[model samples]
Target chain A: MDFFKRQLPTLLVLVLGLGMIIQYYIPTTFSQQVLKNVNLWIQIIAAFTLCIGITSLLRTHYTKIRLQHSGWAYSIILYIVFIAMVILGFYRGIQEGTPFRWLFDYVQTPLSSTTFSLTAFFICSAAYRAFRARTMEATIMLIAAIIVMIGRIPFGDMLSAYLPSFIPGFNDMAGWIFNTPGMAARRAILLGISLGGIATSLRIILGIERSYQGKD
Target chain B: MGIIQKVLNVDRRVIYLIVFLAVAIPIIFPLNLPVTLTEEVMGVYNEIENLPEGSPILIAVDYEPSSSPELNPMTRAILKHCFKKNLRVVTTTIWPTDGSGGSIADKLVEEEARIAGKIRGKDFVNLGFKTGSYAVVIGMGEDFKKTFPKDFNGNVLDKLEILNGTHSNGNSESSLPNAAFSQDARAKKINSLKDFSYMVCIHDDSSVFTWITYGYERYGIKIGTGCTAVMAPGNYPSLQAKQITGIIGGLKGASEYEKLMNYRGEGARGMDSQSVIHVFIIILIFLGNLTYFILERKKTVRG
Candidate 1:
């Protein structure tokens, strides 16, 4: 059982990972064919994973309701909505003008949009409460944020006209900050992430990483 | 208490109420704010503009309804441009669909197609809700037909003439009304990620990374992006690196695009409100810092 669960997955990963890496460099028809098949398999397996994920979510929420956890009412609501959506989806096939589509249009979109829209209010409050220039670094950050905020809107363009021709305008200065310092930092971070990802991938492919099986 | 103390102790509700007013007032009274174009936005516009009519371009609507307010405008503007230029559009969503109104992508795409008088399976197609994110991308890079056997409406991809657009000129196989001769027969032989003239992923999240990493890096496909304002900064590195063609960022970016197209849509209309809120936030930040500094100065004097 240990070998089947542990060794099998590791071996599969090793073979698949090495194969993908090798085929990435190879431009032949056979390599292309392998890549196509592997991608299809990934999609299929991902579909199965989605099923598993839904099942796990249902089980966890069901248990939470059973135990009458602090947020048990929310769990019950979740259960009701989940089941309703599933039933509607299967019954009406999610086509346009269907009951499923109606729920999506009226219920889900509004709820999500309302929730996301509230961020504007919260951000306003947070900026008022937290944005203070106590130190040089904080002041610099504050100035940059202000410039970028102005640049993000058309008002920045209007404001830019008022500034002297020699000095960079709000939008131009903001773009510079974003492209220069911002790009440099983001590039460094992305390079670090890529290197780290490659190392982890190598470890998994070499069978040196078995943490996914709940044993390192 | 003191004025400084009162300023410092201003209620959070007050901030919210003020922001609400700032945003709501603009909506109630139209400002018709002038939108300036950024190079990032202009890059995307120019690329589509320069492409010959009937050129196939992939557009991935990889955002949710929450992002609809911002992202939908970009998608709509791009669609208008593509359809107007007579570009054959192929759309797909790699985002999790089937739950929580994922078909909004389909609805939006179909609406644009309908308005443009473009027929499905010929001028446009939506290969909706594919499961795998990066894997689907890679699969498309290799073979679009194998990746999506059927379109969103369950029509066989084999029957979709839009995918079989000419490599030389990008015209469909059936361009003429009563086709005497179809010289674009080359399209029948080759269809993949690289075959499309360009691809723009209108996304709210990090899916552009997958497109850039796998789709562009591996397949050599040209990619542009219409991303949320916040995400635009994150993608600039990729832009500077020349991985993507251009970026349409946030509502402002969308409005710039709408302006470029000489259309006044939701994006153009919303600029007044968007600008108001941005200026409002900046003012709030400034006022907060001013009160803090004054309070600090007073404390120093007392010491």
Candidate 2:
């Protein structure tokens, strides 16, 4: 059982991972065909992951409902909405002007938009409360933040235009800040992240990283 | 606490109310603010503008409904531009999609195509959603036909004029000389991702990186991106690195594109609300700092 569960998956990863890596260099017809087949398999596997997610959601919600846990009422709502969406999707199809499409356009979109819009309020509140200039570094950051926040808006550009043509406006200054020093820091951080990613991938490919499989 | 401190100490609910007012009032009574054009946004505009008429370009709708408000305008403007330029657009999505499918790529492209007085299969096509995010990109890089055998509307790819060349399937129409000739030079057949004139990916997430790494770097396809405002900063590295041709970032970017197109759309309309909210936030931050400094000075004198 251990061998079937652990050894086999590890072996498959080692072989397939090595094959995928080598495939990039080969550039032959056979390698192309292999890459195509592998990509299809990956897609099929990805689709099944969605199924697994649905199944997990069902199990968790079913348990909560069965136990009559706190907030179990919300679970009922989830089930109703989930089943309704599924039935509508399968019945009339997801094409234009169907009940499914109508529900999507009217119901889902507004709900999502409203939820995301709430962030603006929270952000405003947070900026008012937490954006204090205590230290020198904090002061510098606060100033930069002010420039970027103001510059991103059309009103900022309008205000900037009143200044002399020779002097750069908040727009130009913000662009420089974002593109120059900001990009430099981002590039360094991203390079470190990518290198770390490659290392983790190598560890997994070599079967040296089994943490993802969970504890025995 | 004095007036400044009292104002600073106002309930969080007041802050929320103010933000709501700031956003809602502008939408009702638009500021009609002038949106400034930037070099960053012009990059996307110039690329599509310069493409030969009937040249095929790929559009990836890789955002969800949460980002729809910001990204939808960019998508619409870009689509309008592509159709106006008579460029052949092939759209696909890898964003799993909220089962609540509002404003999806296929539907948006269909709407834009109809308005442009262009035929669907000939002028553009939506290949629809596929699984395996980046792997789907690699698959397309290898061969579009194999990755997407049929369009979103259940139309086989080989039947589409923009996809399969006019002379394909050995039709006797080739014998008529001019009958085989069309505006699209390579419209004969689009085999791989590299065949498209350019690819514009409207994304709210990290999917653009895969396309840039695989589609652009590996296959030499030119890429541009339109993303939500929150995502704009992350995409700057790609824009600076020239991995992408250019970017349309958030509603502001969309409004800039709208100005360039000489058309006022949702993007331009939404800028008023965006500008109001930004300025309001800036004022809040400033007031908060002023209160803090005043309180500190008083405490210092008392000590």
Each candidate: what lDDT?
Answer: 0.83, 0.84
Which number leads on DockQ? 1
- Name the runs in model 2 displaced over 4 angstroms: A164-166, B98-103, B167-186
Q: What level of docking quality does candidate 1 show?
A: medium
In candidate 2, position A167 carries an lDDT of 80
Q: Residue-wise lDDT of candidate 2 within B116-226, one digit each (tens)?
A: 777878878888787788888888888789888888767899778978754221333333233333356545468998888899989888888988988899889999999
lDDT of 1 by residue, B1-303 (tens): 898889888988888888888878887887998888889999999988877566788888888888887788889999989877777788888888423424876777789888988887777888888788899988888888888898877789987777766333234454433233323332433368888778999898889999999889988889999998889989998898899989999888999999999987888777888888888888889888888888889999999
Candidate 2, residue A82: the lDDT equals 93
True contacts kept of 1: 0.79
Residue-by-residue lDDT tens digits, candidate 2, A1-216: 999889999999999999999999999999999998998888889889989989999999999999999999999999999999899888887777788878877788778888988899899999999899999999999899888877888877888979898988998888988898888888898899999999999999999998877798
